[model samples]
Target: MIVLVVTACPAGLRGDLTKWLLEVTPGVFVGTPSARIRDLLWDRTVALCNDGRALLVYSSNSEQGMEFRTHRHSWVPTDFDGITLMMRKHPPSEAKRRKGWSKARRQRAAYEAR
Candidate 1:
């Protein structure tokens, strides 16, 4: 089985993906298409996503029994000792990091200033 999740992508792309997969939700598709078709769909999604993000997950023979691919997203797919992993890439700038930091960080900084 294959499952695809798209976020902030064009409506047309979602419609196109629906042709080959069932859209269980607004931007989520699920199906069991052939590998070639799955790859093609992923390519098309990547091309149409532009600045949006997408994730494709499918059954696999790996240790996890599933594999996933990501495009134009902050979270990245990584390989660790034959295991597939997902990790968030660091923000590009300190300003962005500060914007996302938890309130605990601010509290710690305030305590340190005392």
Candidate 2:
């Protein structure tokens, strides 16, 4: 069994997926297809995602008995203690380091030099 979910994707992509999977709801598809076809569909989805977010979940032999792939999503799949987990992308720090000394430091340096 496999499930696919897409957000903000092209209208044609939804139509294309309907050929192989059932559209259980808007942006959600469920189906059971051969491994080859599943891969092909995922590839097509990635190609057509176009800045949209997509997630593909399929049955696997892993510990969880399932595996998932994602495209253009902030949350990433991670491996922790032999288990697959979803982790959010960390944002960059906003505070930047200053290159030069402060006014007080400069004034102290000048006094010490004298």
Candidate 3:
């Protein structure tokens, strides 16, 4: 069995994928297709995804019994100690931490000053 998930993609991609798999939810599809069909679907999805992100998960004989692949996404799939893991890409430290007080914090400070 295979599952495909697409996010923030074009309507046409969704429509095309529906032809091969059942759309269980807005961006989720599930089906049992041959390896060739699954690969073809994934290739087509990559071509149509453009700036969007996609994830494909399928049953396999691996240790996890399932494997996943991702495209155009911030979170990356990695193999660690023979285990599959999802690693998130975080922004630079400067962008991660606010340089100054947030609006709510500033407002509270002003109220305290009053």
Candidate 4:
């Protein structure tokens, strides 16, 4: 995933970062800007920003899409930084896992147990 920083002061430049992502990283997820860090862009899953203002703009996964959640300024920064660093250090997607059991398997298991 890629992390992006955006400045509200710059309008046209905002799309520049998006365009870059399109060219270099087509499957990137973009996060909203905050009071300090600005923005974060990640690929695949949603990127969490501690900056309470963080908004998710791009996400391949619909579930983790942007949804505003209130957060305190004191804790947000640390949480955001920690989560960002963790994501960068060890990035993983939940969708890549095996499908596990199907309906038929569940039914069979239930019947066997009975």
Candidate 5:
């Protein structure tokens, strides 16, 4: 099975808490206040939708921010419009050190360096 996990905290607590939550699973945590809500919704055991105000944490619809659970592996954009997927990419194995990333984390250092 597949899951879209998300972690969210207040603006002041986003940094450390976001990282901690991600450590719990292969999910993403959104730091921005606006996006945090959306991320949390996605990270739940259920699906979510981006309504531009709050994220529909659990839904039966297949619209924006919707996570489809199938046997297929696919890629979903982190951000569409004002909504961002609170998802992270796992770090490559030791053999992939040359890739210069421990895992697929959009850390502040990495995001700011870009």
Candidate 6:
């Protein structure tokens, strides 16, 4: 069995995926297919997805009985002591703003002052 989760992608990609897998919910697909088909599907998704992200999880003989693959996703799959895990990443400090207030805040301040 394989599961695919796609987000912020074109409708065409989702429509193509429906030919093989059942979309149980928006952006979530599941199906029972041979390993070859699963790999081919993943390959096609990788090739077609533009500026979108996908996460693939399939049954395997691993310790958790599942494996993961990601395409263009910020959270990466990692092996921690032989166990698969998803690692969350924080944005760079440079991307964080340390100063300045928005116009909304300025307006609120003036209102409070009045």
Per-model root-mean-square deviation over C-alphas: 4.7, 8.1, 2.6, 14.1, 17.2, 3.7
| Cα lDDT of model 3 by residue, 73-96, tens digit | 888888999999999887657565
lDDT (0 to 1) per candidate: 0.92, 0.94, 0.94, 0.36, 0.37, 0.94
Candidate order by TM-score, decreasing, is: 3, 6, 2, 1, 4, 5
Tens digits of per-residue lDDT for model 2, 24-85: 99999999999999999999999999989999989998889999899988889899998999
> Model 5: residues >4 Å from true position, as ranges?
1-65, 72-94, 99-114
What lDDT, from 0 to 1, does candidate 1 have? 0.92
List the candidates' TM-scores in order: 0.79, 0.80, 0.82, 0.21, 0.17, 0.81
Winner by lDDT between candidate 6 and candidate 2: 2
Displacement of the residue 48 alpha carbon in candidate 2, Å:
0.8
Candidate 4: where is the Cα deviation over 4 Å? 3-7, 22-76, 79-114
lDDT of 6 by residue, 1-114 (tens): 999999988899999999999999999999998999999999999988999999999999988999999998998988899999999877777667757999899999999998
> Arrange candidates by lDDT, highest first: which order?
2, 3, 6, 1, 5, 4
lDDT of 4 by residue, 9-91 (tens): 13333444564443233322244444233332322112233222222332233344322322221212223522321122233
Model 6 segments more than 4 A misplaced: 94-114
Model 5 vs truth, CA RMSD: 17.2
Better of 3 and 5 by lDDT: 3
* List of clashing residue pairs for candidate 1: none
Q: Model 2 segments beyond 4 Å from truth? A: 94-114
Tell me the deviation in Å of residue 36 in model 4. Answer: 21
Cα lDDT for residue 56, candidate 2 = 91
What shift in Å separates residue 94 of candidate 1 from its native position after superposition?
3.7
Worst lDDT window (10 residues) for model 5?
Answer: 47-56
lDDT value for model 6 = 0.94
- Ranked by TM-score, the better of candidates 3 and 4 is 3
